[model samples]
Each structure stands twice: as structure tokens, then as C-alpha cells.
Target: MNQHVIRPVRADEWEKVKELRLAALRDPAAPVAFLETEEAAVGRPDAFWQERTEGASHGRSARQFIAEAPDGTWNANVVVLVEEAGTVGIFDEAIDVDQGHLVGVFVRPEQRGSGLTEALFEAALEWSWSLEGPALDRVRLFVHEDNARAAAFYRRFGFEVSGLVVPMPTDPSAKELEYVFPRPAAN
Candidate 1:
């Protein structure tokens, strides 16, 4: 377990970002943790990666952070999506929650339990909390029901189940649970 410097994704590093995403998709837990498959990701064009990375990294509505090991290898990543007051969930329910939706969470298996995940979460949550007044009141993430490791990590990080479960769009027969961490009013 090495110390990884967690920082916002750089605009010029889209290629590396694409590589990490594809690697994550190839992980054994991809079926439960990620919607994208290796085959599908590998088929994407360079422009897609460039646009996706630039938009996500520099876009005001969202932010993506990456963890890079001392050797220059990416160890993990997390992206935060800001949900506005009148937005709606994938299920079409009004997204009155006004929250930060965490997505694209991944930690390389070799780096698991090295505290890098916690550091990544801290960086992400700090960014989410740093938003302007009335920007975002809470942070939420969906965890597949069978991904107990992720659920446990969320709980350890002070997140609690919101009692909302949505069937995964990629696999309607499967379900995922939404966990949330409300920002303190004083934040």
C-alpha cells in the first residue's frame, strides 16, 4: 500500500483517465460496482474519452478526482455530480434532495485497505462541502446490494442508508441501495 496523491483530474490527462476506467471495468467486481463493461469501454473512440474527461474534470456541474501512486500509476478515482433542486432521479422522481451524487468510485484491489479509499472519500467530500451557499446539502451514492465491502466502507465513513433502492438500469433484475451523508447545517 503506497501513499497516493489525490487530486482533481487534469485536463490533459484524458488518455490516462480512459486507461484507468477501462482497467476498472475489467475488475472482477465490475458487474456489481460499475455499469460499463470492458468490451463496451474499449469500443469507445478517443473523442469520447477526451470529451468525457474534459467535461467532467472542468465542468462546473461535476468534478472528477483521481489518486495517483508514487510510481505514476492511478490507484483509484471518484466523481461527484451536483444535483440541482428541480432535477430528477433516473426513476423520474423529483430530485429535491439537493445533493452531490457520487459516481465512478473505484480502488485497485492491491490498494484496498491502504487508507487510500478513505483519503479519496475525504477529498471528494471536502470538495462537495466546499460548494457555495445552498450549493449542496448532502452527498449520496448507490451501492449494489451484494457489494458488502462497499456498503461497509460507506457506513464506516458515516453514511447511512436512505431507504431508497433502485433497480440497476443495466440489469433490471438487480437492485442497488442509495446511501447518504447529510452535510451539517453549519457547513
Candidate 2:
């Protein structure tokens, strides 16, 4: 396994962020794992990328973490979004409590099974639980029903199926399942 450094993305690393996202969109599992298309992402302007990076990098309500290889290449990334109570979530469900929503998870083919994914989630969950003003009650993620690989990984990470399923916005014939990691019990 290659050595990697896992860290939160910096606001100025918009270029690297954009590059990694585009690469993710090109992966074979992208269609089922991500809502965005490579075409849409490629058509976006630099300003959009800059704003996105800034929001995830500097905003208190969200964060994007990346695993950088020894040579400085980003091989994996995950974004966590804070959902406040009483708000509508990405799946159109009402948020019942303060929570963290994990999204945009991707690891390069070469880095899969190297423990990078676990490390990324560890950092994200730690950050979510450590928030002071509005601590999260749980961290959640949506996985397409057909993406068994992702679902298994999530389950292995202690995220249980929440029994809430939603139709894919772009393709209602398909569905996504909600998985959640409830806040760990206080020690």
C-alpha cells in the first residue's frame, strides 16, 4: 500500500478538487454512485469549482476531506454536509435532528482496499462529532440500491440501513437507500 496523508481540503486547492471530482465522475461506478454526470461537471466554469471548494473548505457547516499520495496526487475524497433540524434534505426528507450527510465519496481504483476509504470516513466522522455549536446526532449517506459494493462497504463501516428509500431524481425506476451511523455512545 502506498503512503497517503488524509487531510481536509484547503480553500485554494480548487484545481486539485476539480481534477479529483472529474476523475471520480469518469470511474465505472460513477453512474450508479453519483448523481452528477461527467458532462455536467466538465461544462461547469472555474468560478463554480472555486465556490464549491471554498464552501467545503471554509464553511463551518460542511467539509471536504482528501487523501493525498506521497507525490501530492489526491486519490480519494469525501464531503460531509451538515443538515440542520427541520430542514429538507437532498432526498426531500425532513431532517429530524442535526446531522452530517456524507457525499462525493470516491477512491481511485489503485487505492481501493488499501484502507484509504476507512481513513477518510474516520476523519469525517470525527469532525462531525466534534462540532461544538450543533453537534450531530448521526452521520448519513445515500447509496443506490444497485451499488452493492458501496453498500457493503458502508455496512462494514457500521452504517446501518435506515429503511428509508427514495427514487432517483433522474431515474425514478431506480432507488437509493439511506444508511446512517448513529452517534457513538458517550464513554
Candidate 3:
């Protein structure tokens, strides 16, 4: 049995981050589950990976959590990006509140059914709700309509359809549905 530990990535772990991201892009569901391609990711310079890892690891506005196997290999990851009101997002949607946008979610095939996904999201959501400045009102993620596995997982995790649809940037004919987990009401 492999012991898996869930935690945030360190800023200096850029090499590992790059390695895991490449692996994710190679997964069969990459087409609909991820926004980047293996070809593009592999072509990126080391500086880009370094900057990306640094920002996500140390930046207050975003964070990346990874599941480390007993042998020290990262087999899964999830990232949350904080968006403030009036900002334009990657998909051209205008942010209407202080929200956390979940993205870059991936888990290795061997680790898929081991509750790793749930652990990763719990960490991401914990960090999002714990942000001190400009408290978040909700957390959101867009799932490709054809990716039923991912959609089912999100639904099982308490995310509900937000009724906002956006055309896939790479394939305008395809659509992605938005799902949201609203913050619980104050006691």
C-alpha cells in the first residue's frame, strides 16, 4: 500500500512541478480536462516553469496542492486562482465577486480511485476560505461537457451547476459548464 500525503508545493520544486504537469498533459483526458497541450508544455523554457511554480507556491492570490506518494513522487495536483471583482478572466468572464477559480486539476491513473481527489480539493478549498484579505464568496470551476467523470466528481464534492456556459477556447463548437461551491452562511 502506497502512503499518500497531501500538501502544498514548495517554490523551489519547479522541476518536480514541471515534471508532474507534463505527465498530466499526457493523460488521455487532457484534451477536455486541461487547457494546455503536452507539445506546448514541453516547449516552454525552464524560466517559465520556475516562474509558474514560484507564483503558485508563494503567491497569496493562488496556490497549488499536490499528492506525494510514499516514494516522493507527485501523482496529483489542484490549483486555485483568486479572482477579484471587475477583473477579466481567462475565458473572458468578468469577475463579479471575490472568488476562487479551481484549475489545473489532475491525478495519475494509478491514484484516481484512492480518495486523492477529495483530499486535494479539501486542501484547496480550505486555503481559499482562509484567505484574510477580500474574503471569497465562492469557488468555481469549469468542466468540459464531455468530461462526465470529472463532472461527476465535482458534483459529488458538493459543487452545483452555476448555469454559466462558455465555449471552449480551443473548440468553439464544444462547451464547458460552470460549477460553483458557494461559501456557507455565517452562523
**Best candidate, TM-score:** 2
TM-score of each model, in listed order: 0.94, 0.98, 0.97
Q: After superposition, how far is residue 158 of candidate 1 from its true place, in Å?
A: 0.7
lDDT of 3 by residue, 107-161 (tens): 9998888899999999999999888778999999999999999999999999999
Q: Report how far residue 79 has shifted in candidate 3, in Å.
A: 0.4
Ten residues in sequence with the least summed lDDT for candidate 1: 89-98
Candidate ranking (TM-score, best to worst): 2, 3, 1
lDDT of 2: 0.95
What range of 10 consecutive residues in model 2 has the weakest lDDT sum?
53-62
- lDDT value for model 3: 0.93
Ranking by lDDT: 2, 3, 1
Question: Which regions of candidate 3 are displaced past 4 Å?
Answer: none
**Top-lDDT structure, candidate number:** 2
| Model 1 deviation from the true structure expressed as Cα RMSD, one decimal place | 1.5
